[model samples]
Target: MTLQTVRSDILAGTVVFLVALPLSLGIAQACGLPPFVGLLTGVVGGIVVTIFSPSRFAVSGPAAGLVTVVAGAMESLGSFSLLLSALVLAGALQLLAGFLRAGRWICLVPGSVIQGMMAAIGLLLILQQTPVALDTDGDSVTKIISPDSVLVALGALLILALWQTRFIKRSRFLGRIPGALMAVLWGSLMVLTNDYLVPGSLADLDRLSLPEIDSFSEVAAQFSHPEFSAFWRNGAVWLTAVTLALVASLETLLSQEALQKLCPQQPQPSADKELLAQGVGNMLSGCLGGLPITAVIVRSSVNVNAGARSKFSVLLHGLLLFCCGLFFETLLNTIPLASLAAILMYTGYRLAHPELFLRQWRLGAVQFIPFIVTASAIVLTGMLTGLALGMLSQLLCSTCASHRSAIQLSSYSNHFVIRFNQNLTFLHNARLRDLLAKIPDNSVVIAEYESAEYMDRDIWLTLAAFSEAAAARGIMLERWPRAEDPQLVDGGVH
Candidate 1:
């Protein structure tokens, strides 16, 4: 690469690194795992995933959307090592799916359903983090109330909100700095200030906890390994594996699609290749005792906006995360937990914003119903169950709509012509039979299939049976392009 390209990559890489650091820790905490594991996942996403993925700007890491799945799996499995085993299997499933070229099918998932899933995840984050933000560590409200913690969270949140304003965004220098990094810095600075001034006053405030490793040499002790025995012994492990594979693969494909839109100048990446890259990253991360990984839109967006022109930026960011875990654990532990909670709460708000709901509602019932149902189900039940219910609801709505508009009946006196307006399938067979039986006796009817895109054998059989009975009822039924004509293809309409 040219010198200019190298310089651009370095700058972009630094920006992405800054954005990923605090978020990674927060995501791990949200999943009830060690803060270091989240950073490890980011490292794998940046280095390993970047090496294998085809997209130039795609950035991989732990995503907020998977928080529910990861938390539930952790609880059900009852051990981090057990969860790692499931994660490894999830990665293997993704690898198999990639080899099978299943990535393309992700496009068939409705946009509404995807949005609903995100909104639900966002709502969950808000609910889950509110107590943390408030620093409510005790059962009683009086004992749980910690003014110092609440102040820190609110101050960090205010800083984040102000950073997103048009005035700050228009500033050339401030706009380039990620708001998340700034929030973390603000929290750290507050802790330092309190320690130097009135340390005993804020002693009750909780801070991030990490092992007291003095040097890079001791960092290896933090690495974890999966319990291989859990793979076969616990059926829940397999269920968790399936859930992770499906969700991670879907999120990765969706991120790739979004990246394509953001960087239309860049050639589209192979979807299957993207899946393979993600699979490998998760497998490696699991082996090292890290959380599951996926192509995350937040980091990728930061990478692109910061002028990343190659995967070098992503790789560089990963290296930075590795170094952070080794040398910066002491400084990292000084960050207050309330600050991270605020950051996560803000992220959740963005996902389940009022505007997102209003936008879906404006799209009409067909889209809004599924979107709301998916979000509600996910919040009330769980991710997989909610998605299944949402898909079923969408299918029912789409089928009803198709049945209403799929055919048209036009009657000119006793001469009735039935025109197929859309594709015919088994689902339409019953409706077709009902319409045919309504035709009056001694009537002349015409069966038209020229407009239909596709016709199933069941539909054709229904038509043939109607034609047979038409003659007995003195109703003459004729085909548009005679049945013997070459244009009348079998099982398909042209």
Candidate 2:
């Protein structure tokens, strides 16, 4: 690479690393795991996943989307070790899926369901973090209201809120800095200021907890391992593994597709290869006791916005996370939990924003109902169950729409026209039969097939039966193309 490109990648890598650090820690906390495990996952995503992935701008790490799944798995499985074993199996499933070329099937999932799933996760984050932000340790209002924690959380939230405004974004230096890191700094600054001006005032505030590590060896010593025995003994482990593999792969592919839009000049990455890379990363992350990983849009967007030139930038970010864990453990622990909670709350708000709901509403009920159902189900049930419920709702909505619009019947004085506006399948057989029965005996009829792009065997059989009855009833059925198409002449019935 040229010096200029190398410089750009280096700068981008640093910016991504800055963005990834706090998110990793906060997401780990949300998953009920230690903060360092998030970093460990980030390290694996950056270094190991990047090695196998072809996309230059896509960045993978512990994601907010997986918080519900992870937390739920932890609660149900009762141990992080078992969760890690599930992740390993999930990774294996993803690897096999990639080899089977199942990535292409991701398109079969409707956009509404995906949006609902994300919105649900967003809502979950907001709900889960409220207690942490308020320092509400299941106490009364007065006891829960800690001045230091509340102020820091609000201040960090304010910074994040303002960070996206054109005024702040227009400033070159400020724009280069990530708001999450700045929020953490704001929280840290509050603690430092309190200590310097009025010590012990911030003592009661909830702060990040992490063991101090002075060296790489010391950091490695804290690593946890997966319990492989859980794979065979626990049914829940397999179910969780399937859920993780499906959700993680879907999110990764979607993020990659979005990143591709941002970097239009970049060649499209192989979806199957991306899946394989994520599988390897998750397997390694599981072995090392880290949170599950996926291609994260936030960091990937930052990498693109910061002018990442190659995958080297991704690799560099992993090294930075590893170095940070060793050298900056004390610095990280100084960040108040309230600040991280605020950051997560902000992230969640973005996902479940009013505008998203409004947009879905504007898309009509076909999209809106499924979106609402999925989000509600996720909030009420769980991730996998929510997804299943959302898909069912979507299918029902689509089927109703198709049934209503699939066939058009018009008649003028016994001259009838039957127009197929959509592809016909077995699902439409009954409706087709009913429509044909309505035709008056000895009526002249026209069957238009040009509008339909396809007609399966069931539809063809239905039409054949109608044609047989048409002749017996003294109805002359003319096979014709659509009236709008002037290129074809009508042919008599079969």
Candidate 3:
């Protein structure tokens, strides 16, 4: 990359690092780990992966979607260290998948499913962070936010509104800053003012701290080693690990693809190389007592928005994290939890905003219904499950709607008119068969198929059969010349 590109990348990277910092920690906390582990993963993903990755703009780190899996793994393994072993195994699996060229299969996931996944994640973030935004102590996902949280959410919402208004858009100072970041800064000020105005009204804000990883032995003691002897005995653990790997990889591949589309200067990464980078990142992260890491869309979006032009942005982000960890720990810790909540709530709103659904609805119900169902399923259930169901529903709807071909057929007493609008395939054979059955023997039937652009083997076979039947019935079969079919109009035949 050129110096200008490098400088731009660094600027973008800084923006992404700031946005990712709190999110990584929050995800770690949500997954029942020390917040520092999340920071460690973010650093490693930014620094180490950037060196080996092919994608110029994609940012990798701990993802919120895998929080449920990590939390469950910790509970099952009975220690964070044991969970690390599984992560190592998970990394191995991803590497193996890359080598096997399985990354291409991710493209098979339907667009509806991917859209649903995004919408679900957005909703999950909203639900999880709403409590934190309100300064509530609620930890349960199902818990309702108190009135205080409602007010705080509204205040953050107002900040987002002001940031989006034309006044801020035209302002030199505010226009250059990200609206979401501004919302966080304003929300932090609001929290401090509330604390000062009414003492003890807001809960005591927790201080940030450097993750404590003093010794290798301490890391070793966090969890039991992976039980190879009981590998078959504890099938559940293996299954969970494999599931986690798949989900993480899917998210990574999708994020990389989306980033390439969003960032004009950044080309898409080689899927296999990305897999290896993530595998190495996860292995190191797990060893460092951190949560599993993957490419996150939110941070990638921030990087793109901040004018990132190359992979250096990821490296710069890692350097920032390392510097914060080594020297600016105290300053980082001073950031209030509510401020982070405000940032996340704003992110969530952008992801699943009502306008997106409304826009999808305008496209057609075929697309909109699946989008709504996917979003709802994610809101009601978890991400992966919701995606699976939404994809199935989309496939069913598509298949049911595609039962018959679009070619229209009409028949008169003496002549039969078969007007083909587009391509004909096996799907159209049934309709063609029904139309052919109504033709009378010894009648003059003009089999018109001029509008047909292409015909598959099955349709060709059907036509040949119909030609034979029409010949026996003394009916004339007339067809226009198709570039691929030179037999058309041969001596007033086919």
Candidate 4:
């Protein structure tokens, strides 16, 4: 709020704005929206949302991961405007989620699943952007890759290597310059110079255009307005809207966690508040014929890297977008698609590093298998379905392990004892069911846990339920807490 603070924010925002510009456009294009909408969200997200957001240093804008979903919705609705309406609905849901303090639910997602998601997204990025980086053009996703892309990818790899080299790493001046940004600049210049020396050597850069605000109706017409009658008639629309809201919320929560790691001094944003902020931003952007917005990790990292001390950095970045749109629109069009593609490819690599998976594998197969399965599902199918399958697999694996470690039960005509050797979970609840079913009415039951290391909530709840049922049966239940208890009766119980 102060002048000094304002000055620092301006500097930080400038850096982030530079980083966000290409990304916003590329993501918007990928989502099948006019690139301008991406810019609009980036500007609005920074300028407007940051004012009320809890995380002062985190930046928000169009996210690359949401591109496919947005595109599919637009295609399904047969109108971009209707998708906007869905975005508004999605935003409203997010706000409600925030108010309900449901953001904490993100923590319930297993860490392995999250790692798998990031890795999959990274792989997707490399696949999608590599072609663009090489200036390849084809109508379909498969056609995007060419020999040229392979060369360009190599160039990008070299740039990354140089950026990580000790000389650049140790130099304060050099380290401050983001290697991704530098690569884009160098690549753009190389393309431009190549064009001058040998015409048509590089792909024609005639596709870029400056967005103009001719009339409000023109912008409004771009989006396909939701038909209330149609929406009610079809359940699919509602399902899609719910899916968007849930996925967007999860991504935002993850981005917030990542942002906190990047800038620890800043207070963490309340999940609910963060949700509301993103919802409002998306709602407004969609209303104006823009794409959906979310807490993007790349821009947030850029803000932190740029020395942003507060949310004002976001505001400043938005201001820059507004000014560019208002005054220097033409200059913005000069940026080549290839340069933007390079930026995305770099971002993708960071997201889907192979080494992350290697590290997870080292932890244990229980952790690594789920992570790989989740990643594969996401790539082969879609995000939500893959995640569901992964979670199910994790549950099954856990249950099997628990079943294998279960203790045997022995019983007499009047008394019975059941023992467990390992921790218990919901997966192991069935064992209790079988044991209790066999116990005779009015029998004495000894529930032993001497070998148990831990018990999850589900197991505890099941036991509590069994205790109630046993009481009804006129059965006395005694729990042996420790292995050293006097009533060993070791015979076969050990």
Candidate 5:
């Protein structure tokens, strides 16, 4: 690569590194794993997934969308090792799915449901992290914030907001600066300055706790394997694994699609390939005691907005994580949890931005209803349940929304044409028969399949029989199919 290209990749990677660090820590804590595991997932995802995936701009990591799922799985399974086994199983299933081309059907998922799911996940992040941002741990949802954290978090959010404004985006210098980096750096610097002043306050602050190492050589020793004690013996564990596989694959594909929209020039990712990459990453992560990994949109978006040019940026980001984990783990620990929470809160807000709701609302009821239903359902129930409900809503709408081409009838003088506009399936056979019977006496009826390339033998046979009874119905019947010339014989084209 050219020197300029290397510099650009380094710049983009640095921005992504700042964004990924706290998120990795927070997501791991949410999943009941140590901060180290989450960071490790990011490192592995950037390094491993980039090697397998075709998308040049997308990045992978422990996704915020899976925070609840991972946390719940660990709680139910009763062991982090058992949870790791589930992740390993999930990864294997994803690999199988990719091999089977299961991801090819992703287009069948409605965009409305996808949007709704994203909004729901965003809201979930905000709700779950609010307590952390306010610097209060509790059994109750509403806890009074610590006086010190309130300012730290607010200031961090404000800095992020200012950095993301249109003015900054249009500016030559500010545009190049990542908002996440500015927020985190400013917040960390202020905290460090205060800690320097107070001497002992740094020891009492809630910081990201990570094991320290002097060099990159120690990184290998930190890797840990999963204990597959509950495999096969517990159906629940298998079910959870299947759920993880499906969810992780879905999230990865969806995030890939979203990022492609932001950078349309990048080569589109193959869903199956994406699935394979994620599967391998998850498997490796489980082996290393990291939380399950997916192509994360937040970090990917940050990478894009920071002007990522190629997969080099992804590789560079992973390298930074690896280098940081070894040499600067202590400095990262100096970052207060409240500041990280603010960063997450802003990330959450961007995912479920109010303007997104407005844009969808303008698309009409067909879009807005599903978007609102999915978001509300997710907030009240959970992600999968909410998605199921949203899909059902869309199905009902589609069934009610009939079309003229679904079944049409035309007439010219004594010639009444029974036209199959597009689809001529068994499902429309009854309607075709009804229209055939409605042909007036002494009129010539035509069973037309000229516009439709497909039709079932069941419908064709019914037409054949009806043709024989043309005399009984006082009407003459004919069949016109593309496979043969128009036939006006004693019976149908059968």
Candidate 6:
């Protein structure tokens, strides 16, 4: 690559790291883990996954989707140490899934369900961040607006405004700024100046809660290991691990697909390789007292949009997180929780944007209904519940919209013209046979399948049986020519 490309990637990497810094902390807090655990996972994901990831531009880190599950698991499982057992198990399952070649089945999942999951996650982010944004201390999913969080959220929102909108962004001077970092900087500046000017007025406000570390000994004290003893009898833990594996894999696959869509020229990523990478990441993170990691779309998009040329940018971002954790923990801790909440809130907005819903609607009810159901179920019930309902809708509607008979037959006075869709398989064999059976005795049948890319062996065998029946009934079948043999269309008659 050119030196200019390297420079661009580096610049993009720096910006992504800046965005990641506060988010890791925020997601960790939401998941009931130590703040550093989030950073630890982010760092591990960057350093470990880059070696194996097939996506050239996608970034990996702790995801927001698992927050509710992880937190609930922690509450029911009794301890963070015990939670690690589930994380490790989830990683192992992911590794096994990759080896088993389950990655290719990702396409079998309906698009509406994926969109619904994204929308639900977006809503979840906004709900979870509301408390932190307002400086309130309990769950805010039900209570979205808190009186206390108003000022803090508004201040952070203003920072987002300056960085995102025309007021400051329209100016060439401010266009280059990263809005998330600015929000953090502005919040910290307020905290710093408030302490100096008013002394005690803002002292009670919630700030970034991190380990008070001055030495290696203090840092080492925070390290934890998974509870190996409980692994054999913990049925609930196994369920949690399985849930984590499924959700993490689904989200990673979705992100990888989205990344491919954004960078269509880049090589398509292998789902199996990504699963393996994540497996390795989670295994290590669990052992080292960190949260589970997955492919994070927000950071990945930032990396790509910032002109990143390769995975080197992702590697560098991880290195930055590690180095910053080691040497600049104090500076990092000075960041306000409210600022991080704003960033997440913005990220959530991107995921559940109204435009996404509108686009799904334009795709028609077959798509929109499942999307809406998934979003509503996740919001009203939970993630898994929402996904179940969405998948049901997808399967029920798929017959008319997605999976359909490939062959179309047009009848003439004495003959019939048969047209085959690009993909012909066993799924279309039944329909094709029914159409063929309707042909009258002594009819001239035009069997055209020149466009069929893949005709299954079963389909061919079935057609052969039908052609024998047609021959006994005195019907003559005409062959259509293509690059491949016409046997599939001519019913093995060559």
Candidate 5's C-alpha runs over 4 A off are 141-144, 200-204, 214-222, 261-269, 301-310, 403-494
Candidate 3 TM-score to native: 0.75
Per-residue lDDT of model 6, residues 1-494, tens digit only: 88998898899889889888877887887775667888888899888877778877878898877776687788888888878989999999999999998999998878889888878888888887777777666654564554434666677777776676677767765665677777778778877887789887776666666766788898788778899995869897887788788889998988888887887744577889899989998888889898888998878988987889988899999999988777777777666677778777877887899999999999998899889998898888766677889899877776655445467878989788777766666777778778877778888887767566566777767767766677788888788333346554644423
Candidate 5 lDDT trough over 10 residues, lowest sum = 482-491
lDDT (Cα, tens digit) per residue for candidate 5, span 1-494: 78887888888898898778777876776665668887889888999988998788889988887886776677778887778888999999999998998898888888888888878877877887778877777566676657777777888899889987899989998777667667667667867898789866545457777887765566677777877754779876786788688778888988877887888853467888888998999999888888888998878988887777789999898988877877787787777777777877887798899999999999977778888888888779766678889998877656434433466788999888777766566777777777766778898877666566666677767766776677887887675452333542422333
Best by lDDT: 2
> By TM-score, who's the top model here?
2
lDDT digits (tens) for residues 225-305 of candidate 3:
344454445655566668678888988998888777787443446899889888887777766666788888778887877
- Which segments of model 3 are wrong by more than 4 Å? 1-6, 68-86, 134-152, 187-232, 264-268, 369-373, 376-381, 410-416, 419-494
C-alpha TM-scores of all predictions: 0.87, 0.87, 0.75, 0.76, 0.79, 0.77
What's the CA error at residue 127 for candidate 1, in Å? 1.1
- Model 4 steric clash total: 6
- Cα RMSDs of all predictions? 4.1, 4.9, 5.9, 8.1, 5.4, 6.6
Q: Model 1, 1-494: lDDT tens per residue?
A: 99999999999999999999999999998887779898899999999999999999999999888888898899888999989999999999999999999998997898898999999989999888878888884457776577888888999899899998999999999999999999999989988888889876666777877777775666788899999964787999998999899889888888888888888644579999998999999999989999889998888989999998889999999999988987788899889889998999999999999999999999988899999999999999888899998898888777787787787787999999898988888888888887887789999999777778677778877877776777789998776433344545655555
Lowest summed lDDT across 10 adjacent residues in model 2 is found at: 485-494
RMSD of 6: 6.6
**Model 2 alpha-carbon miss at residue 299, Å:** 0.7
User: Candidate 5 at 286: error in angstroms?
Assistant: 0.9
Rank all candidate structures by their lDDT, best first, as comma-separated numbers: 2, 1, 6, 5, 4, 3
Residue 158 in model 6: lDDT:
76
lDDT of 4 at 428: 74
Residue range 1-494, candidate 4, lDDT tens digits: 68887777787788888777767877876665666777787887887678767887778888877765675677777766567667777888888888888999998888888888777877777776655665565456665454444554466557866987899978988876777666555555656676789877656542346656566665555443444445655555665577678878888889889877767753456888889888888777766667777787877887877767777788888888767655665555555666566666666777777789789899887788889998999888877787888787777766665586585678877889888877666667777677768778898888777676566555666666777787788988887343333443441223
Better of 1 and 5 by lDDT: 1
Tell me how candidate 5 scores on lDDT.
0.79
By lDDT, is 5 or 6 better? 6
